[model samples]
Target chain A: MMLRNTSNAVYRVAYESVSKLSRKLNAAKNIDELSSVFDQYLKYLFNFNALRVHIVVGSDHYYFVFPLKDENETEFWENEVLNFEEGLLENGVPICQNLNAEQANSLIGDDVQNPVLWGWNFQYEDYCAVTSLIADENNQFSSKETEILGLVVDLFTLKYYELITKAQLVEKNKLLEEAVDIIKQKNNWINQIISDQQNVIDERTKQLRYQNEQLMQLSVLNAHQVREPLSRVMGLLDLISFVEGDEFEEEILPKMKESAKDLDEALQVVINKSIEEIVNVFDINSDKM
Target chain B: MNRGSNVLKVLLVDDQKITNFINLKVFEMVSVENQTIDYTDPEIAFRELDNHNPDIIFLDLMMPRLNGWEFLDRMKSQKIELPVVILSSSTSPEDFSRAEQYNNVLDYFTKPLQRDDIEKLLAKL
Candidate 1:
């Protein structure tokens, strides 16, 4: 498939979501808040967390800072900070920050290693101000939303590959079908040739049978009608060949020789016809027998 | 210092550190007096833009989290109608066609963005 005409609007929404989530993840005070926000934001957009989030904070007061026990403990610390801020605010501390108690808690859960310091104001010296570093261990803050979006892109890419493979399979199947058809056609032709050969053999057998019957019929006919006359003609031709030539005898002898040759040729034709009839009769009798 | 206020402030957005450095150098050599806010993180980039309004944006098309087109879309939604020049190594016809669809995109340039290219873009401004 070709690259989709992705709406600039969709791209913008995805981008802003990523930016917002990244900002939130960075603003988060501990690992607990980070993972929760990460999980919540990503569950909607993607299935995997491709971009690993790492949070580390450098505390202003080194003695008060506690080591991050684990990811779960970090979330707990963030929750505690929220409760602490709310308690302080309810007691009448004038804070100009726009974040609500819930929003603040959600923003900076237990992900940070140190207390994030905001800009210090001389007018509010009594209140602690801290800025949060929204970063992984490498100081990179890839938002949970962004990570999920990356996963979506990956899944889409895999789907595209699957489509291509399916198309290839379809083409291969078409070629296979054509090959099968050709093979079937060749088989039919071979079968037809075998049938024709069988037909030819049957015709030749019929002809041989007819010829054998004819020879038998001619054998009977030749015994009565042909042999006696043919024998006499042959004797006369033999006599004419032995005679000497004289003036008057020569003319008479030539005529006699011509007549004997004609008779002999006629007898041979009669014998051949008689034999053909005999074979035909014999072939008919053989079939009956 | 008085003339500095009149200079164009160009924001260079890219995930790679070296690309940002190279672009910044090119901008400088073009005699364009400008301050660049480099954002390797696309999410961070939007915040930087909201905070510091730049005269021009040189945006890369590909990145880990927020791609160039995504960033532009976000910027447009926010009504930040600043001049945006798409800086990408992809010169595919389809890429160019897609870039053309965006009204905010002043031009599409194939990268290693040169000083001459920057100068040419500045002249257009």
Candidate 2:
């Protein structure tokens, strides 16, 4: 939004008024100084209402945060701020003449929608200085005020912007510090969880290794035991086969077949046991790996 | 009406009258065990706190005259240790953490008060 040429005269007058107000505001050291400055500023800026200004000042800005004075005073201030916008500009043209306080409500009236034209925002950034014209109903630049208000506003804004920038930097620094602390906290917590999980893993690995050793010993022992049984069954089968022939064609042949069956059963048991042992080792090793 | 030792006195603080009304109804119908006194004005609520040692307090955050955070600050400065339960529609994580930071807070519950939630919460009490 650049400054227009139409509102040169009015912009200077408004800027002068604002300069006076700003000087008073800057000079104010205490409540008394503030009150005096605010009184003059309100009178010059808003002549429509009857009010006495009492406001609270903070480090960066003024807070209407809590009303420190009589409740009636607030109503008066609102009335002035609202009605000023409802009034006319230098031109005969009405910003929103058809609007009424009861029906349209000043809050939603011409000032809010188009403040620059109505001179309602005389204290607004640009208008506060004398560098810009108050825009018209069509938002055209003021033929009377021009860019004087804009210049003053720019100057003041630069100062205020610098302060705001510093504040923002401080806030950002605080946020960065907080983020760092949170990251540190999360890192510590994750480390703790990892350590706990590692301990459990170590304990489980030790138990599994011991169990694997025991199973290996059992497999070797069981293999030896199966071999002894198989050898006994084989010897019996051989003796029967040798005696069977013609003399034992009936009873001797039946005994030889029974011995062979026992030997086959023993060999099958040994093969099954070996497979089971191999599978157990594979499962344990796969899980650990 | 009858009075007993189990009959508890509770304080309800919020700027919104509708919220206070709904909370009161819920308290009468759903609260397992407690009596209540409701106040819309935060300043008045603080005064009521001083006068009445209520069993529990249900507080809201945003207010016109005095905000909930300000009320809490005052209470803390004054060393007023009443078990406060934050009853707010705001589910901001910062608000939750802030409530936790204070020792006076007993619990935090979001809006649209549920019957089962209140029952379980009261059962613990």
Which candidate number has the best lDDT? 2
Model 2 vs truth, CA RMSD: 40.7
Runs in model 2 lying further than 4 Å from the true structure: A1-289, B1-4
My TM-score estimates for the predictions, one after another, are 0.30, 0.29
**Model 1: per-residue Cα lDDT over B21-121, one tens digit each:** 55665565567677777778888878877677788888887677888878878877888787788876554566688888888899887666766777877
Q: Can you write out model 1's per-residue Cα lDDT over A96-118, one digit (the tens) per residue?
A: 33334444345445343322222
Q: What lDDT would each prediction earn against the true structure?
A: 0.54, 0.55
Judged by DockQ cut-offs, is candidate 2 incorrect, acceptable, medium or high? Answer: incorrect
The 10 consecutive residues of candidate 2 chain A with the worst lDDT sum are: A48-57
Which residue window of length 10 is worst by lDDT in model 1 chain A?
Answer: A117-126
True-vs-predicted CA distance for residue A162, candidate 1, Å: 72
Clashes of each: 35, 27
